[model samples]
Target chain A: MKSGDYLIVTLAAIMLIALYVNMWSAPQQAGDRVRIVAEGSEPIIAPLDRDHVYRIHGRLGDSVIEIHQGRIHFASSPCPGKQCIHAGWLERDGDFAACLPNGITVTVLGRNPRFDAINF
Target chain B: MMRICHGAVLALAVIGLAACGRNAGEHSYRLFVFGTLVDITTYDAQRERSDRAVQQIEAAMQQIDHDWHAWRPGPFTELNARLAAGETVTLDTVALGQIRRAAQLSATSHDLFNPAIGKLIAVWGFHNDDAPSGPPPTPPQIYALLSARPTMKDLVFGDGNTLRSTNPSLQLDFGGYTKALAIDTAIAILQRHKIHNAIVNIGGDMRTIGRHGLRHWRIGIRHPQQPGAIASIETADDECIFTSGTYERYFEYQGQTYHHLIDPRNGQPARGVLSVTVLHKDPAVAETAAKAILIAGVSQWQYLAREMGVKQVLVIDQNMQFHATAQMASRVKFEITPTPDLNISKTVP
Candidate 1:
């Protein structure tokens, strides 16, 4: 076989290994994005690295969410229970906090989520 | 010829990599129902078919939430009112079926999962969506309700759809049990639509069918004290994972936290355990067992789990210690570092 053919075969083998490594390697360390889903609206995805406060108008009222230092939490919410605020900060992948009455949820998203759902 | 073969090999490699695009065939829809978020995921399905299944699931779940609302002015509340007024009520077939199943489960848990303590639940101020910020009920109030000793046994089912409660205080609150029913209903809808691979997650509790493409669906049990999972489990087909935790629904009062998992035995939040997670194929059984085990506390969880036919169980005590059944220990991978002192106990035959 020609050296060009051999090189092509070698390149193909290297490419296959690279693809496998990309697919099967360890999941990235922590969540890098926050996904917010509110009723009657398209879900919003934002980078986790930026610390900011955002408000989404929900069924009950506005739910105030805060992103601080690579973490997210419900700063305040119109729902009577305030359970969303009580959920504290969500910094890890697959972690989520929801205001049921208000119909808003904040979830951390990463390359490979740790679980399909979190059972509390 | 050799060069052509190499080119073919490279072409196959590229195609295989393209096929491995993450989430290529995954479709997910989320809705707020049953007083919480319901997530429906379908893998390798046509978009139209998955959308139709999700639409039906949303409609069915909304119907259940409306028909069975415990505190709201609804059919279930009307039934409770009639039962309180010493009137025999004829229930619809669906209501009758659910009540009968809940009663049987209550018996199996030895009344630790009593749905007849609705009066106690109300007295604790948990009957509403508004989190109970307690000036907790006085002991006299709790004792007065406790003295009635209301239970599912108090409900007399007389011939076909007819029912009555002997005790006026015997109100009905399905709580987690009803959520389980909703999950099951969602699964049934997905199956009817021919969506074999899916996960139905109501709030944090979930039930999974088929798989996520190639592997079993992975689930995380939320840590009561930490941000991430306490442990992870790879679920088999038609498996339901239910957890009852102090963190789910609770309020703080006078420096103490009171959750909504009311114990019929004490007419207060079940104490001594932080959380309990149960795995089983039946959603209702898993849901009721998680509640019963949490109420059973550390000393009697195993006995209660055994009685309820729940082989996989995990309990986190007040001290942050993990107690898992042998079956559960074999299935769960603890995600915590140094794996906080897990004690494995035998699930006796």
Candidate 2:
């Protein structure tokens, strides 16, 4: 085959690979967001897709929140129990992590959640 | 105004669908009724059909709430009032069916699941709009009500739907089991509308019809001690899954916990069994059986399950020991199995 045809084949292969990768990994951005509610204040809504820290100025004190790769958690808090961090990752809808001491909470939400009903 | 309302809703629905794109095959509608979240999820390739089906099911739930609410000033309240007044009250067809079923269960269960203890329930402070808080009814307070000993037998089912209570203090309350019937009614409405893929979740107890798409419905039973699910179970097609737990409604009183699951026999919070999960084809049976088994405590749960005809049952007692029926053990996928103290038996001695 000609040199031009070889170059064309390699470019097409790379393009196909890129398209397949984008299609398969797209649901990660399925508009999955988290609602962070600070006690005595309106909720601070943010996207779960982005990796960032939200220092919520709560009534008691500030709470440092973290969102990493479509998952969220209390990276650190001033609360005594540290139960919020122990709650681990907040990745699915209705999953909640709260530092009751500092009066801060994070809840995951999306259109079609994993569980239809949640029992206590 | 009616035409305008219809047109506006149709426009919003169309706009909402277009915004979500054609690939969105699943639709979810969350409505709050019966003082709990009622979520309707349907998997239909046509989004519009899913939306309409959910609307009809939500309407049916609202109707059930209006008709059967126990304490609210509705049909149930009036019936209880009439019965308490010692006057013959004629029940409608719907009321008669529910009352009869409730009465039969109350009788056969040895009053362990009696709804006729409305007065007892109210005296315990459970009749409040929300979960009863601390300072539970004192011993004297409880003894006063216990003296009456209200039972379903107090109600005499005369010819047809006519009913009268011999005990004037007797009051009928179906709060214990009406959610189960509501769940069943919601499923029937969805099926009648030819929508097979749906889930009717009342409060936390739920039932599903058909597959989410090509897979069976999956439910996660929440652990009594934690914030997450302890085990997951794949539901049989059109199966009803329910859980009765102290965590559902309770308050701490000087380190002691007082829950809302009042034992009809003694008129107090059931002493043992943290929670019970029952899976069956009938929603009402699954819920009622779970309640009966939970109140039965660990020592008698196996026998209760047997008498209740519940083949699939999972129970976690106050000691955190996990127990499952052979049938339930085969289906449960424990996220975090309990400690070495696990009971995998048909019955416990």
Candidate 3:
């Protein structure tokens, strides 16, 4: 109603804005599940039957790769030249795994009937 | 007049309340140091004290880098180089002591965590940015160099820092343990400066000296293949979380891949196990666990952990399956993708 009240209201609005910005600016949540496969290891077909998709965590040399859903990607790898994590995710079904350092191979397969045996 | 008086009183009250909220215990400060610890947070009785403690720790880190860095020529470095060159160099008591301890560790680990891999790393262009633009060295090249590699036993330490190496090609590289040593040194410096509560994270190596308010330090383990992806979050009291993943270094050529973790047995990058995280009181153990897990592979890691009495470790296998020790399960909460089949059983420790 008065100049003093208006100034107080303005300051309160600014404080609220700041609080909201801080809360929203928090770090993004990582993907729900990560499937890490090593090179020469057998291809594992974990069920993607659930509506929730999964991510592939593997290495391409020293760089780590994270393939979210069906896309192949890099998370973090230790390669001296970190070019892999930047390569983005692989979308196709038969795409080669992005990780090479630990001889890791990752792939997304259709949910199979045999998914029940492998425990998390 | 009455309205003005009331406004003045309200402003004073607001300011007083704001001032009261700024009490000593409410504020927390985080310190970021690039070397030794990647990130650390500390809170002190006063902001000034916390800043002073950080400054002192930074100074100590610089000193550690100066003395222990393979690129630098400190007493130990000079002595190690001279020993490799067949020239006898006098050593100080402190240098001799450190060498002796390092030698024992090298022997105990059976050279898995060799402190003498500097030349090999340099040849691979790990130290220099202008690496040779070509395919990684062939298997034969790696093997030839590995065969001639000097054993830790070749190092001969004596009183007065005098030392010699039987192999002229021996080059000391403390990459594996130097960072841990720096963390210890910084902790000591913080204690000396009378700062009791601090968390030091050098890269992914973490050390928490004391509690934060009533809560333990919470650390998130980055997923091996996911950049900025946290696979799990764990809490520790006066412990450190040190991790090493296979993705740390490597190159790909023609669909083939090469990584930095060389298997001592075959002179090629170790296979299997995406990442290894060790939780313990000693940063060195965390460091050693990372290296050892890479060398030992996934199946052997569990046995090794049990034998070594290492309580906490998380190993993600090649199948995208996640496995954690009992201790790790207790400390870490996991989020599995595609919903892993959860199985919990105690293997003999």
Top-TM-score structure, candidate number: 1
lDDT agreement with native, every candidate: 0.88, 0.75, 0.58
Residue-level lDDT tens digits of model 1 in A1-120: 777777777777787777767666765544489999999799998878899999999998899999999999999998877878988999878888888889999999987776777777
Candidate 1: which pairs clash? Answer: none
Return whichever of 1 and 2 wins on TM-score: 1
Better of 2 and 3 by TM-score: 2
Using DockQ as the yardstick, the better of models 2 and 3 is: 2
* DockQ pick, better of 1 and 2: 1
User: Candidate 3: misplaced stretches above 4 Å?
Assistant: A1-120, B1-37, B71-77, B129-134, B336-348
Badly placed stretches (over 4 Å) of model 1 are: A1-31, B1-24
lDDT of 2 at B163: 90
Clashing pairs in 2: none
DockQ, Cα level, model 2: 0.16
- The count of residue-pair clashes in candidate 1 stands at 0
RMSD to the hidden true structure, all candidates: 4.3, 9.3, 11.2
